[model samples]
Target: MKKTITFLTVLLVSINMYAQENLDLLTYAHTQDINFFNSIKNGTQVKEYITVSKNSVKIGDTLILGTPTSEEMSIRTYSGSYGTKARGGVAQSRSTSKKTYEFIQMGRPAGFGSIMAAMNGDAASMADNSLKNTTVIVNEIKTYHRGSKNKPLYVVMVLGELNGKAFGINKYLSVMDTELAVESGEILLKNRKMTRDEAIAKLKEAKELMGIDMMSKEDFEALKKELAPIITYKNQE
Candidate 1:
């Protein structure tokens, strides 16, 4: 019995190790991506169903895709002397005139949200992402590494094709200074097992009703239970 248990434990550990190895470990620079990164890591600790990674994904798995945000960068130029003026009479850091340009999110993602985001961004949101109601299923999973560092960044990209139902969101978070092209934030990889978008919307409505005492706690609870699955990213931080 002891030998059997030991072998089982070792097998389980090995399986987990293999899964982690096949997964992509990525880093995010934006607030939205950072939050998503943190949430995915934290969420896994609290729930079970699946973990977001390449190894766990297979062909035909439905996925929510991210849209393009800011693929361009603007320039800011400044000029001056060691003072306020080009020939500073007063003491100040020699600065020049100023010219600045930035990419801002208009709270929307450019088209081709699937390929672009998968290649560049770190996360995707279930709610308020680029393609609201449109669904994508995995067509391919590609893995690669970049950079010259000892630990190169490994990316496992999911190439998806539209399942085609509906698209668009009631609301979406925007990246500052970017106007369509790439939205590098608010990528939601965390999920609540919902079969329909209306389910989440209904839950939000119910919560609102409960808050205003239009619905009793018991009634809201009942509704929530019937809705099954969990959350809606209505006011996520």
Candidate 2:
């Protein structure tokens, strides 16, 4: 009985290790070939969904996408000496410039009334008083297939309201940005589990890239401890 138990434990561990190696290879492949990742097609038909808090929106309501400007300054200095022994003074001047090209508009304006009517009055609302506070909803949705199984890749346009004012929030939903993408219909795909040795190797490479040397020893230990479970392999089956 003891011998059988030990053998089972070793078998499980080996299986877990193999799974981790597969996951690492897949992740590496996706990073190397983005078009290959995006080319994957799934059979799922994408649908639009919306969630809102506050008063219902209608047609003719204005939606604003505000983009604040950025400014930078460059300085130059000159030094000169005249009519004095070992006397010199430095003068410096700076010119301020603004960057106007970084602004991005995700989508064109759509009337709130027309949008609500188009959906056959499918809507939601939440009540709040602060003029600056607003609830955002995915008003327009598009999808494409990505990955080997052709999983759906959802891109959505977000709309919001502050007080009685309507506005546009974002054009694209991306995983790198925030968790809100999930609410906006972004799909989360499963990755294969990794084994202990493979996890450690991958983590070491990540630590080097993250400049762990820049962190205090305590901070480094804290971060590692927090991430240890995430990097460690577990049996999914």
Candidate 3:
């Protein structure tokens, strides 16, 4: 009986150790593809989700990606540096750089308003105010195809980060310059989930709401010709 109990205890210890190893592996996996590099400043705890080779980078500064000798990804600044330095010195140092490798969210954005904010650059209210520990997805717009007569509508599903800060909040926590794109006649927006069909319907509805003529046969043909080579990214299942 004592031996049996001892065996059980050893088994439990092994399980715990295995669990710890698994956790370590997960933590290690998180930093495997860090693209952003930040220079350490003021000793802030750098966020794990956003990778920076250096813990802090200065404001209005350009940080090279991959290597110091490599191409410039994006210029960086922080909210902490703003008035004193760049206003959002901490924030700016933490946000993903434009040159950083772009990533798409695994699935649609979690909410409609969030999607809208993402699309319109109003994500500050919706996203965690802290740029350090946030996740934003970005996909390059590949193509825009006007549908056939039967389809009669266009579909545009934006799946990735529109730009830095997910929705317009700059590294300095200041409002960044914004550009608007019309998706299906509605401002291309984010922070919401749209199935392929729903995206199509919304775009169609937007067109109708805007009083734009439905795609004519010729327009549809021309649109398809236009979309022939644009390669958009899709969510990976």
Q: Is candidate 1 or candidate 2 better by lDDT?
A: 1
> lDDT per model, in order?
0.37, 0.34, 0.27
- Model 1 — TM-score against the truth? 0.28
Best-performing candidate as measured by lDDT: 1
TM-score of each: 0.28, 0.25, 0.17
lDDT value, residue 232 of candidate 2 = 47
- Ten consecutive residues with minimal summed lDDT in candidate 2? 18-27
Q: What TM-score, to 2 decimals, does candidate 3 have?
A: 0.17
Writing each residue's lDDT as its tens digit, candidate 2 over 63-105 gives: 3322223233446654454457444565555665543212222
lDDT of 1 by residue, 1-237 (tens): 687557556644632332322223332221134343332321111111122211133445554434433233335444446455475453334333322112212223322342245345534332323344334554333222232222222223232335442335313222221111112322223242333455778988999999999999999999988876435333322
Give the TM-score ranking, best first: 1, 2, 3
Candidate 2 — which residues are off by over 4 angstroms? Answer: 1-106, 109-137, 145-154, 168-219, 229-237
Per-model RMSD to reference: 16.9, 23.2, 21.9
By TM-score, the better pick of 1 and 3 is: 1
